[model samples]
Target: MTRLVDVVVVGGGQAGLAAGYHLRRRGLDFVVLDAGAEPGGSWRHMWDSLHLFSPAEHSSLPGRLMPAQPGRTYPDAGHVVEYLTDYGKRYALPVQHGTRVDAVHRDGDRLLVETDSGTWRARAVISATGTWSRPFLPAVPGRDVFTGRQLHTVDYRRPADFAGLGSVIVVGGGNSGAQIAADLALEGDVDVRWVTRRPPRFLPDDIDGRALFDVATARRRALDAGRGDTGGVASLGDIVAVSPVRAARDAGLLKASPMAVRVDRHGVVRADGTRAEADAIIWCTGFRPALSHLAPLRLRGTRGRIATEGTRAVDEPRLHLLGYGDWTGPASATLIGVGRPARNAVREIAALWARS
Candidate 1:
């Protein structure tokens, strides 16, 4: 028997939980399906030393404030996990844990959500599966021949894993790359080399995720108003100089080189044909959206991402995507940013049901 609901939220992470919050407020019958055994989502898998670029106050969901840690400016990953776990409990959101969704397809005015446990027929589906499960590593020539250790940022747990390595290269320019490089260089005996496609942009020392969010909001408003210039605002891509990164910079270890062209048996080969010897390569390249469950719908546009207008799929209105990042909505992947889109998505879904 197929259970039916007004809506099915395909993830129990920040985005899915936020959507659940609004859906409950609207008095909609909705169920949230989480693949994980626990409630924290991807935050539970983050490296131990990781901390939010923003302070707790600036990095919160819609209703509850993330509790500030005593004597700590930025909350660690564990703190976020705890907060999310508590938030779900407080709201009593209808989240089904350990239920992995396999596929979603159209079933005549309703969407069929097939899961490992059972199938749900929902009037609408909100996909918040997020990117953590889809880590991306760029292809380099001769990569198959490399005998050295290679891994993506998703697999990285601690610098101690590479402690005794002779040389290590960290490939990426984002916060993950910078922070991981800093961690390995500061805590390990390995020689750390930072590689980026372009020189990384670092935000001012006084700025943080709060400032970045404000700028993003402003830019979003401007774009909505059909105006262009955002007055040269900083982007989220700019690195926030946390203490370890700052120390690494001051110690002259944060310097980056151009991306390597190929991998050799011993190490990576530069564009200029020079080779750098390394025992391991950590690719912090980033992730693609986890939209595999929606594959049967054939809703993807270019780049395998569903075309969205403020969370609703452009082609399939019944399908909404959240937490996939800026393409779906401004700052949709962050803790502070997911709420607005979630509310918007729920409002649209409710209105659709009203007309039916």
Candidate 2:
């Protein structure tokens, strides 16, 4: 059976829902296809101890504010899930849970969104499928020969999982690596070695995601006006000092060591020609965009990213890519930052649809 909509949102996460909200404002017919079995998207699978980098009120989609949690500066993973689930309902967005998009290709004037449940030919397609589904693990030399268990940020859950391990090596310098290392260190008994390719950089204690978003916004505005690069969140530094990370760093437990030059059958080989034995390795290296379903479009460049003019694909204007990162729009990957890009993308789609 074939279905049709003015727009088909490929992922029902924050980016998709935000785009949906604006689409409704423009009176466009659309449906959101989510691969998750439930409404929360990737938040449901995030680590149990995870918390938003910003407070509840600071993080929201287009239409409603996330209800603040009592006695907490930051909302936990479960809180985010509840908020996202409610956001979809509050707007009465048409989201089809458990529908995984298998492919997207041209179907004459419309794009065919083929999914596990069915197919929908949409006049425009918004690919908001964020990077959570695709975890990246670096190919460090001798990683194939490592005898220890390896895990990525997506696969990690709790510190208790490593209760009996001799030593745990966490690889990466970002927020995930810092937090995961902190979580494991909080266990008190586990030996944790945090590794980074370069020296780890920590943002000041007062700065959070909201501050970062503001900086990014300023940088974008400056660039748009030909004011040259004013620098964004990277200027502030890397990891934010959320409570756990702050405590871990203050206690001298989250100190970063240089990344091991190579891995051995037993563990890792440090640059000093010394070996560190590890029972487990957690790779918090980050993720690539989840665009495998868009492969049929053949729009990706040598850089492995789709070239875009704002959110619209350069090669296929009918398609828009959202929430991938700065190339699509500055700070578009964060909850607080995605709304602008989503709204802009939908407006562009609406204009194109009107002309067609």
Candidate 3:
């Protein structure tokens, strides 16, 4: 039997749920399909010490405000998971958890979403399957030759996991690298080396997710209005000094090294031919969009992204890609940031239905 819906949301994380919220409000029939066993999505897989860039009050979805955690300035990964779980239930959004999408392609005028469970035919498909599952580890030469155990951001859990290891090298200068290095440094026993391709850039202490988001929004507005270039998020800086990262920087615990050009059997080799010994390596390199399920559509570019006009795909009119990052919408990957794009996506879908 071919199940059918007005809209089929792929990946029931914050983005999918947010889309569901707007879809429900417009009286549109939709279903959010999530691969996770429960509601939290990728947050459930984040490191133990991870916290949101902003306080809970500023980091919320469209309809509901994330309640503040008592005594915590910024909510942690666990808190985010709970909030997402509650958000889904509170809205009574139709979400089929544990449903893994295998492919999404066209079946005549409607889009066919094939999954492990069954197939759903939808008028519109929103790919909110964010990048968590697809961690990006650059092919540093000799990476396979290294004797040390290698892990990506997705595999990391807590600092204690690296405890007792002789020397640990953390790669990438982004927030993940800084925060993970800080977590390990706090142990006072682990030998840690943090490395980045470029020197680490820290946003001012006063800045948080809210400021970064504002910067992105301003940039988007400027381009849309044809105003002279106002610098985008890059002007703000790369890493947000969350509590642990801030403390580590102040304490001289978060020093980073130049990127390693290659890995050797013993350790990593720097560009200048210096080899750094390591027992383990943690690559906080980042993630690529999780769109392998859409491979059948052949819409992905060389960079694994699709052509988009706002949230809607340029080539595929029936598909909307949300929450992948800035390319989808301003700050579209964050908890608060995703809501606007989610609304825009649902609105476009609704408009399409109306026109049809």
Candidate 4:
């Protein structure tokens, strides 16, 4: 039997949950399917000491307000998960957890979405699966030759996991890399080494008038203007341009080289003439979207991402991708910035449903 709905939202994180809530509010029927056993995607996989750089007030979903707090700093990973769980209950969102979507394809006018659990027939599909679906690790020559343990930042959860490891190298200069180095330095006895590109320009936790809000608003407009795609020109004004480098430097976590040429049992060879040896290498490189289940959908784009605009599906009107790059705007991939895009997506979906 093909279970029918006005829309089917894939991924039960903040973006997925937000989209589902808005669709419901617009008097539409939709179901949210999440890969994790619970809500909150990266929040569930984030490190123990991880905290959102954005303040809670600005990080709240569309309708719900985050719990009041004294500190203006961003909420920690646990706080984020708790907030999302509350958001789901408050809205009574119909989210099906532990339902990993296996494939998504078009069945003529409708979309056929199959999961490990069951198949659903939806007029629209929201791909809120997120950009961090799979952790990306660059392939370096002789990488497997390294004697020490190697892992991506996604697999890392606690500092205790690295205890007894004498020395560790944290690769990448982004927030994850900087935070991981700091965590290991403070929590364990291991000496921390950072392999990164340029140092990030770290802004204050709160920049001009709540930086998160400012960034989100700017990104929303950019998305609406259809300038949020991957290939779109980089208009630095639209994204949060703050650098995390100063923070990394203050923490003594900055490395000289950005590019990794190769790896061997000895150490990592730098693009310049240098080598770094360590007992473990934690690659904090970004993630690539896992669209294996989307093979049946026949998405054609420069990258694997499915591109769409203003509710009219790219190739198939019935197949709408919710969380794909710039689906709402340039920064739709972020936790705090995702709400507006999610809201926009649901409204677009509702309009489509109404016309049918």
Better of 1 and 3 by TM-score: 3
Candidate 4 minimal-lDDT segment of 10 residues: 233-242
Candidate 2 lDDT over residue span 207-298, tens digit each: 98889889999998898888989868888888988989999999999999888999989888889998889999999999999999999999
**All candidates: TM-score:** 0.97, 0.98, 0.98, 0.87
**Ranking according to lDDT, highest score first:** 2, 3, 1, 4
Q: Which ranges in model 4 have alpha carbons more than 4 Å from their true place? A: 69-72, 204-209, 219-248, 251-258, 310-312, 324-327
Candidate 1 lDDT over 146-173, as tens digits, reads: 7889999988999888867899999999
User: lDDT tens digits, residues 65-137, model 4?
Assistant: 7775556365777888888998999999999999999988888778889988889998888877776768898
Candidate 4 residue pairs that clash: 127-322, 200-245, 201-243, 202-243
Worst-scoring 10-residue span by lDDT in model 3 = 183-192
Candidate 2 residue spans exceeding 4 A from truth: none
| CA displacement after TM-score superposition, residue 354 of candidate 4 (Å) | 3.3
